[model samples]
Target chain A: MKRFFLSDLLAGLLFSLLGFYILFEIAYFPVDEGNIPGPRYWPRLIALGLILFGLWLAGSKIYSRRMTAIKPNLHHPHQRQVLTILVMTIFYILLWSLFGFFIPTVLFLLGTMFVLFPFQPKQKVRGSIRISIYSLLIALFVYGSFYLGLHVPLN
Target chain B: MDAILQAFVSLFQISNLLMLLAGVFLGMLIGALPGLTATMGVAIFTPLTFFAPPEQGLCLLLGIYTAAMFGGAISAILINTPGTPAAIATTLDGYPMAKKGEAGLALGLSALGSAGGGLFSVLVLALIAFPMARFALQFGPAEFFSLAVFGLSMMIAVSGGSIMKGLLLGLLGLFLATIGIDPIHGFNRFTFGIKELVGGVSFIPILVGLFGMSEVLNRILEGSLQDKVLRSKLGRVFPTKAEIKRVTPAFWLSSVIGVIVGVIPAAGGDIASLISWEQAKRFSKKKEEFGKGSMEGLVAAETANNAVIGGEMATMLTLGIPGDAVTAILIGSLMMWGLKPGPLLFQDHIDLVYQIIAILTVATLFSLVISLYRIQTLGKWILKLPDYILNPLVLLLCLVGSYAINNSLFDVWIMFGFGVLGFVFRKLKFPLGPIVLGLILGSMAEANLRRFLILADGNWFQFVFHPIALTLFVLSSLALLSSFKKAPSL
Candidate 1:
């Protein structure tokens, strides 16, 4: 079952599904006053393309998968890091919305730098301080340049 | 003629000149970093650039564009890794030359050759684009529609060997582009009752996501925090007259090839360099001297790759089509600043157009001098910077650029969504070029198509009679067919 659903095939099916959804939504648009084709026309054209291409991608891969004896590797070494970054990003955005720009931005910068810094098990104290100072400098630079120098109200 | 004079004066202004230098220095930094592409750099910086006066903003953008191309040569020469994709070929002979302790000479020649090629292509661009714009000024809705179609055809042609994936992404872009209110009609199409979306998915956020955030995420996934670099000490960096004479013919021919390929839409510097390298190998008197630190190989690759800049600007300014991914972001920035990049720009802001040309010329000189002066010291410092710090800074910048554009939190979320999409597309080998190209041109193509339909009065076939329209259609078809037979262009 896993082999039956490849990435390309999944992308293809999703695209086709989105195309169909949009095709159905085109009906909700108010009617065109002119006798000519309306807002629905372009969407219809693209919907057709999506369906055709999606089918092509899936069918081609399905045929090839049967011929080849290959299994896709789904695991990656940096999966935890990637997920952590994504969580941190969402939290930054949430923090920005709750508080004004400065605190959230500074915290986000520090957090990101800390996450990215490769921590050694033995030499923790020295590395932590270096990254902390570096993150503050970067945050200050960004704040000064964008807000003070250029009058782009960060908040 | 007066417009040209004014353009020269405008470019010589102290502020404009300062911006040019700043852009070049920043571009050099970005290009010297591995995993930070010129396209992504330009895209990330575009929103911030918009805050400047239009002319100065444009100068800054042009500086970044040209210098980045030259900057790629730095990493390619010092380390085995290319700073940018355009410098991939430069690494072949470049690293070898460095191994023999001629890193300075190699750097000097690359900078000199790149400047020469850039200027040569600019000359051709000046000759060709204005006339082409004048010719296109006579076009009707049908003709413009055909031209837009022709541009879309470039999506598959440069899909990196996969037409299906390119077409899929292109179609996706076209569909997403339809999210705003219909051009001809007043009704909203895909807003889903959201007021923010009524104006459509903002171009800045999308660009930030696809190019900027996606890069940061990918680097995070790779988890290589430290820099893997060489400690090559560059010596005496000016090219001898004899060395210049030796590389001149190949340099000249490669420049020509670069412009042709660049003008073809989607065929970028990487493709031009590869093709020019092959042609140089065939044309060289010393065929056996190829690839083992051949001066001709380095010259051809660097010259042709940089030459693509001028050719790209020509297409982007004359037509609305992008010459490459970087120009696609430029188009987005142009639109953000309320300047449409088409034939109308030539008529309305002729001086501004010429100013871009002048800036390109000046940026070349500036980049050449800077590269020759500081290749050894600056290259060492840049190569030492670790990825962990750089990637986070870029991610922060991308966030600021997105949020600051409209002061909208929604746009940031939009950027996040597209970043995921871009990552998936990259992993699946889908070309990002078509997506950006399609998004930018989608409205233009759709509006023109509808206009043509209305003009023909229900007779779709009759509108194809215009010679330009017919010709464009034919050319697009031929391009599509050729793409099927050939390797990926861009």
Candidate 2:
């Protein structure tokens, strides 16, 4: 929670810096006097307000740190499952770009099922295989719908 | 009446009806998938519509627009994640219902509410579109600028928990809007001389990164180990007569609010839903049941969001100005077909306008039917598919989606870069929504400010002294100030 507070403070400081940078840019622009309001006027005002607000956020968070944690669910430790999914996603993207759409999608679906929900006593190998086949069918169906049916011209 | 008859004649075409169904079905699927928002769905599909007649193409897009709003509720009910930002409010009540094993009931009420809202809004559009368009024609550049400011102020309404965070994000969005080439002088502001920066950041890529990639990264970091896969029992997918009767008034009210808010260039489905929910909460005798599986809340949000489609379209069709990002793309699609939008458009191409409106109305109905029937069975099956298999495929789609925008490999890389940035932001708990909004709106904001300055001869008073502009300036300031006061400290 303290880390969260500190991070927010840091974000506020970054925004404040950005606000000032904008202000600096506005300063360089020549102001036209004929118009009711100059071009830099409103932007400068907004920037000033943002700077003030950012400073306030950074200042106020220094004293307030009461973290309320929600109870951890049973599936909290599936970090590998998440990582595997992310890696698979990157692979899927690269594969799709190199080898076209359908092939990589099928491979991704099969690979994911094999890794994430590996056969267990309660979850039989047959069930996983059936799920994989069904997933493939769904993927193919989607491919046909989007690519063939809609003519997305997937490269 | 004449326009309605003409619209009917145009919509009666078999091809138009079929395309409407296709658009609705595809939109629902896209909406049901977490991170594939309605805007993204519309953006990806808008190009495909170019081959068809403008009416048929618009019919399909309208179908997608309406159905996608309802489609987001599917994931919100079965999974805790909202498929679209508009469904964020829906998830508050919907996920709880799913947890309590009332997923079927939640879906039923959502569909019913959505249909009611859609039907109501279409009727409004049918009756009021022309008049509204005529009124909107009176708006000058200064008025339009004020309108943008007013629209920007709604960010405060969406800011939940920390007003400071929301303001920070909103400002961040405004800053990002300033990036790329200045609209007035064509001088690059923040592109850093990068050729890719000249066009600024593409909305589609940034959106894909912020919503899709960030979600994947968040899931990875959070570690999906503890997610108990709740198998939602497929029950009767229709609300009871009693439930329908109770929600009828809320549906009507939300539709009215949705259309009114959506007609404004700055306000969108998200704001419309928020306003409707607030209104529903205020009026409902069962207000306590809200955020705890109240059908009224789901109905209000779903209906309002769907209703926004017609409302937003009214402005786009009558005036050339797009009400939201999706509409902006839709405007591009129409322009690609050599169809101009505005009063002159209606006068010169009345049949085309009528055909398009007819297609939209029919498509809205078609979207309702497909969402109610086709998605019920598919929704149950989709819920059971583990995210491990699904998330990767979505990422691929996102990559293709980004690349497909301009057929540039560079955009794909930009998407990946933003994805990494999004991940870092997520890790640091910095909100990403405003950043995307900023990037999308930056150029517009800067251009208008510059134009206003040029017109005013650099007089600072011009922005504040002009009646409409002054009101907007004050309103945006108040909105920013109020949001700061409401922030919940970490």
Task: Identify the leading candidate in terms of lDDT.
Answer: 1
- Where model 2 places Cα greater than 4 Å from the true spot, the runs are A1-4, A16-56, A63-155, B1-18, B33-40, B43-60, B73-109, B174-180, B216-247, B261-302, B314-356, B371-376, B423-433
Model 1 Cα shift for residue B61 (angstroms): 1.3
lDDT of 2 by residue, A58-81 (tens): 876665654233332536545556
- DockQ for candidate 2, please give it: 0.30
Q: What TM-score, to 2 decimals, does candidate 1 have? A: 0.95
TM-score for each prediction?
0.95, 0.77
Candidate 2 C-alpha lDDT tens digits along B175-268:
6555566566555666666787676666566656665666665654554422543564746677778988898878888999999987776467
In candidate 2, how many Å is residue B370 off? 3.0
Q: lDDT tens digits, residues B45-70, model 1?
A: 88788788887887788888888888
Per-prediction DockQ: 0.52, 0.30
RMSD of 2: 5.5
Which docking class does model 2 fall in? acceptable
Q: Which 10 successive residues of model 2 chain B have the least lDDT summed?
A: B220-229
